[model samples]
Target: MTTDTTALRLYFPISARASATRFWHRLSAPALAHHLINAARRSGIQQAVLHPIQSGYLKGEKLTHHHPEVTSMRHPQCVELIDSESALRKFLHDHAAELHKVRAVLLKCEIPLIPNRQAG
Candidate 1:
């Protein structure tokens, strides 16, 4: 059965550091993707995708560096998840702690998805 309007798209703003960036040992992009994938499996949501944003800037304070040639590439990474409204809500509620661990932006949009027609 096709997903209904209850279907929602959730966007999460992540980083090169991923979810565990705030912790002592930061997570690499692949590590973070694995973490999220596992979490989704545990949460019973099948469809998810991790996206890497290229050539984007952040909206926070400037950084201070000790060395002259150590400029940081701090572009934010991202992931977008699609699921039923209820499932999305439940996932958010269940993973509140994870949210706190990472700097993220969670957005819900109600855009209807029209699948492309197959070539006959």
Candidate 2:
């Protein structure tokens, strides 16, 4: 049987898919990401990763210049965090007021983590 446990995933945009400034509460996307990251860490999330996006577009938004062939429009980034429920709850509590300024998604889902194997 696959042992599935509850884990929380948080996703937020870090940069715009363009050279122009995209604002999140008067801060640039990357700046906003930095602000959010600091908040997340201070709220007790142990680990998170910021990944630069290559070729993806958000729905209902204007088509971003996110084509794989385009190199100039490649600053957009996303940060992902996977952690336990208690820690996630604490983060939500801490950032409750600031949460509305950005497009942050928190998902409660199940994932099958690969078991680590060691060779002697």
Candidate 3:
């Protein structure tokens, strides 16, 4: 069976930090990614994945890669989520505040489902 699906990809800096509120409360890169993943799970998203890139750069930034000599630097990270179009739309709307801080792309596509056969 083929069904409609939407792929949501969120891109951000791996070492970037975000403020949670007006106060000093902040979230590290890992923490922010985890928070978003948890939110996706709670929102009934079918799948959510976090990918750490070894070398890459975002818009208006210089490319960076992992080096043994360097101890700290910013790298690109991506969070991918797949689900129904409506479900993803709702998720984006619900998490607009947090999502606005990152770059996001939504792609519409169809997913084919294959059934399993039992051995006799």
User: Of models 1 and 3, which has the larger TM-score?
Assistant: 3
> Where does model 2 exceed 4 Å of error?
1-30, 66-76, 107-120
Count of clashing residue pairs in every prediction = 0, 0, 0
**Across residues 1-120, which tens digit of lDDT does each residue of candidate 3 receive?**
567888999898766554365344543234567778888999999999998677888888788885667723456778899998888889889988777768989998765567757798
Tell me the deviation in Å of residue 83 in model 1: 0.4
Q: After superposition, how far is residue 98 of candidate 3 from its true place, in Å?
A: 1.0
**Whose TM-score is greatest here?**
3
lDDT of all predictions? 0.53, 0.53, 0.78
State how far residue 76 of model 1 sits from its true place (Å).
1.0
lDDT of 2 at 89: 70
Ten residues in sequence with the least summed lDDT for candidate 1 = 7-16
Worst-scoring 10-residue span by lDDT in model 2:
11-20
**Which regions in candidate 1 have their CA more than 4 angstroms from the true location?**
1-30, 61-73, 101-120
Best lDDT among the predictions, by candidate number: 3
For residues 34-98, could you state the per-residue lDDT of candidate 2 as single tens digits?
A: 66567677766767767666555444344444456654332345666556766777776776665
Compared with the true structure, model 1 gives a TM-score of: 0.53
Worst 10 residues of 3 by lDDT: 21-30
